[model samples]
Target chain A: MGTGYSIRRVERQDYEGVLQALSALTTVGSVSRTQFEETVDHWNHVKVSSEPEILQYHPYVVLHGEEVAATGMLFIERKLIHGCGLVGHIEDIAVSLHHQGKQLGRALIDHLTNLGLRHCYKVILDCDERNVRFYEKCGYSRAGVEMQRR
Target chain B: MGTGYSIRRVERQDYEGVLQALSALTTVGSVSRTQFEETVDHWNHVKVSSEPEILQYHPYVVLHGEEVAATGMLFIERKLIHGCGLVGHIEDIAVSLHHQGKQLGRALIDHLTNLGLRHCYKVILDCDERNVRFYEKCGYSRAGVEMQRR
Candidate 1:
C-alpha cells in the first residue's frame, strides 16, 4: 500500500498505459488505439451481458498516480464436469520494471484471483519457472504442466 | 481408423454421451438433461454468432456407432497481445475406458488442435504427468508450469 497506488478495472483511457505495463511480460507489438478500444468494448459488453458466464473477461490494472503499473486478466471457462462448474484462467499478469519490489504484481494477482474465485470452482495460471516461487507465495501451488503447440 | 468410429461436432442429443465420456476424466456429478441442453444451446449460439471470436466454443465427440466414445472442447480466447491475436485452450479431453488405445483420443486432439490453429496463434493445454507424454506425441511441448488455487 504505497501512497498514490490504486487498483481498478481497466478502462478505455488506460489503453497505452495497460500496454506499457504488459510489455513487462511479453511482446505486445504495435496495437492501434482503435483496435484496443474495439476489443475493450467487446470485452466489456461480454462482461455485462446475459450470455454464458464462460465468455466473461475480467481485466484489471494497478495505477500508481494515474499511471498503469501492473495488469492482469481473468477468463472464466464453462465446463460440463463438476456439475457444470466454472474454471478461471488467469493470464497476462505483469508489473512494469520500475514498479518491481513494490508488490504491485502481487496486488494485481490477488485482485484477479479473488475476482475469479468469486465465480469459479478453481483458478489456474501458467508461468515461467523463475516466477513459480512468486506465484506460490501468492497462495498458488503447482497443479500440472502447461503444454502448447505453437 | 476403426470401423464404426467417427468424430464430429457434438449435438444436443449427445449430452448424456458426452457426460459419460467425461466421467472417465473426472467426476462429472449429476447434471440434469435440461441443464445440459440449455448450456449446449448457449454454446452453439455463441459458436455461430459474430459476437467476438473469444466467445466461440468448439466441442466435439467421437462416436462408436451409436455410442459416444470420446469428447474434447476448444475455447478461443481473444487477446491484446500479438496484435490482438487469438489463443486456444484445449480442455476436457477424455476417452471412455473401453475406447482407449483406439486412437480416438488422439484423433479428437488432432482435430481440435488443427481447428484451433486455423484461427489461433497457439493452442495450449494443461495435463497431468501421466498424460504429458501423450500430448507431447501430439506435437505439444512443455511450455510452462500450471499453478492453481482451488
Candidate 2:
C-alpha cells in the first residue's frame, strides 16, 4: 500500500502516537516493553513540561493519516571552535514496514538534510553497513567504516 | 602548567560540572544555554537514577584531581527492529582547554569503549573534521566522508 505521510516535530499531544509506533514495531530489534514505555513516557513528559527546549533537539515520527510509521532523531547542530568543527548528527532512524516501499524514508531524510543545512550544521550522520543503500539513495554517501566493538 | 587530569563516569551531583563545560563551549557550536542545560540535566538524572544493570550505559568525566576535565557516554546495543537498534551513539562530548595536551581525551574514549563492550553495545560516534585526527588517535578511524546538508 502506498503511504501518505506528513512529518513534523512532535508536540506533547503527539506522545500517544509515538507510543503507538513503538508498540507496533515488533521489527526484529532488541527492545524491552518496560524500557520502551519508559522512554516514550520520558519523551512525552519532556514535551509537556517544556522546561527545557530539549525536545527540539531530537527527531520525531511520521504520521500516515494518524499513524506513526517511522521515527528518527536529529542532534540539533552547533558549530564548534568557530565553525572549524563538526556540528550535528542524525541517528536512531526507523521506518515502518508498510511505508518502506514508499518514498517516506528518503523523504524524512531529505527533510532532515534541508533542516540541517538551514541550521548550518557541519557534520552529519553516516549509516551502518546494512542501511548504506537506503542512505545513499537519500544522497548520503559513506564517510568511512563505522567500526563498533562491544 | 602541567595538565593534571582524571576520568570517571558522571554522577547526578556533577550536574554543575557538565553545565560549566557546556557554557564554556557556547562559541564552539550553535547551542542555547537554557535548552542545553535541560538536556544536560536529563543525562544527569538518567545516569543517577538508571538501574544498576543499565548504569553501565552512562559515561562521565575524569577529574584531574577535582575538576571535570573530560566526559564520555556509554550505550547498550542490539539490532532490534523498531527498538533501540542495539547500537550506541556518543554525542555532546567535550574536553577542557587546560587538559588538551594530555591523553585524557583518549583515555576517556577508551573507557567508554570498554564500557560499551561490557554492555553488549557497539559504540559509535561522529567526529568533526578537525577532531578526526583526535578520534583517530583514540583508535576510532574514519568511517568515510560523513556529509550532512541540513
Candidate 3:
C-alpha cells in the first residue's frame, strides 16, 4: 500500500533496478553492463519516432519510490498482409515478488495494450497456459496455436 | 532446372518479381507501388548493420531464370533471459505455385536457420499444425504449447 508508485518509460539509471526486478521471473545471470547498455541503446534508437509506431520499442517500468518494482516491453512489428500493417508483440514482463499483489503486472499489460491499440491493428503475445487466464481478463481472448522449436 | 536459379538477398530492383512471388502465398490485394517502395526502404534501413544480427532483417528471394519464384523473411529478436540473447523469427515465406515441388521452401528455411545459428543460440518459428511436419523435417522439433489471444 505504497503511494507515489507510477509507471513510466525506463531510463538509463533504471537499468539495475529493472534487471533486479526481472530476475524474479527467470534465472538472470551475470549480464555485463555493456550488454545492458547495448540493449537499452537499441531500444531507445527504435523508439525515436511516433508516426511509425513499429519503430518504437517501449519498455515500461513500475516505480515505487524510484525502485523498479516491475517491467515489460512492447515491440512493434510491421505485417505485410491481412490488411494489418502494424502489430504489437508483448514480452519480458516481470514483477518483483515483493510487489506481486500490487497489480503492477496488470498495469504494465494495460499500458502496453493501450499503446498497441492506438498504433496497431492487433496486439499479440504468447504465454504459458498458467498465465492465459490473467491475459484473458486483460481483454485478450484465446486465439491460434503457438509452437516453438525444441 | 534453370541454370541461374539461386537464392539471394532481395535487391531494390526485385520489387516486381518479389510481388509476383508473394501473390501466390495469399490474396495480395493491390499493394500500391509506393507501399512496395516504402517496404523495401524500411528493410534496407533495418539491415544497415550485421554485427548485432538482430538489426539485420534478411529478405531473401529465389531467382529462377531472372524471375523471383519464392521469397522469405527472417527477423531477429533479442531475449534477455534463458541465457539466449538473440532469437530468429521466420516469417513471410511464400513460393509461387509453379515453384512448389522444387524444394524452395526448404532452401529458404535452411539459409535463414544457418544464419541464425551463427549469431543466435536458437531459432524459432510458429506455424499451424498443417505446416509443423515441414518444419520438423527442417530440424525443428515440437517443444512447447503456443497459446495466443483470439
| Fnat of candidates, each listed | 0.86, 0.44, 0.34
Model 1 docking category: high
lDDT of 1 by residue, B97-135 (tens): 889999988899999999999888999999998889999
Selected candidate, larger DockQ, 2 vs 3: 3
Candidate 3 lDDT for residue A110: 88
TM-score ranking, high to low: 1, 3, 2
When 1 and 3 are scored with TM-score, the better candidate is 1
**What CA root-mean-square deviation does each model show from the true structure?**
2.1, 6.7, 3.0
- Hey, what RMSD does candidate 1 come out at? 2.1
Give all candidates' CA lDDT scores.
0.86, 0.55, 0.74
Model 3 Cα lDDT, one tens digit per residue, A46-143? 63234554455788899999788999988777645544266677888999987999878888998999987787767887777688888889988655
The estimated TM-scores of all candidates read 0.94, 0.57, 0.86
lDDT of 1 at B32: 91
Compared with the true structure, what per-residue lDDT tens digits does model 3 show for residues B84-108?
3666777778998778888889989
lDDT of 2 at A100: 62
Residue-level lDDT of model 2, residues B1-150, one tens digit each, is 234665666665565566556445445444445544544454444321244435313657778777877665653322324444445656556766666667766777777776665555356776656777767666676554454442
Per-residue lDDT, model 1, residue A26, is 91
Best by lDDT: 1
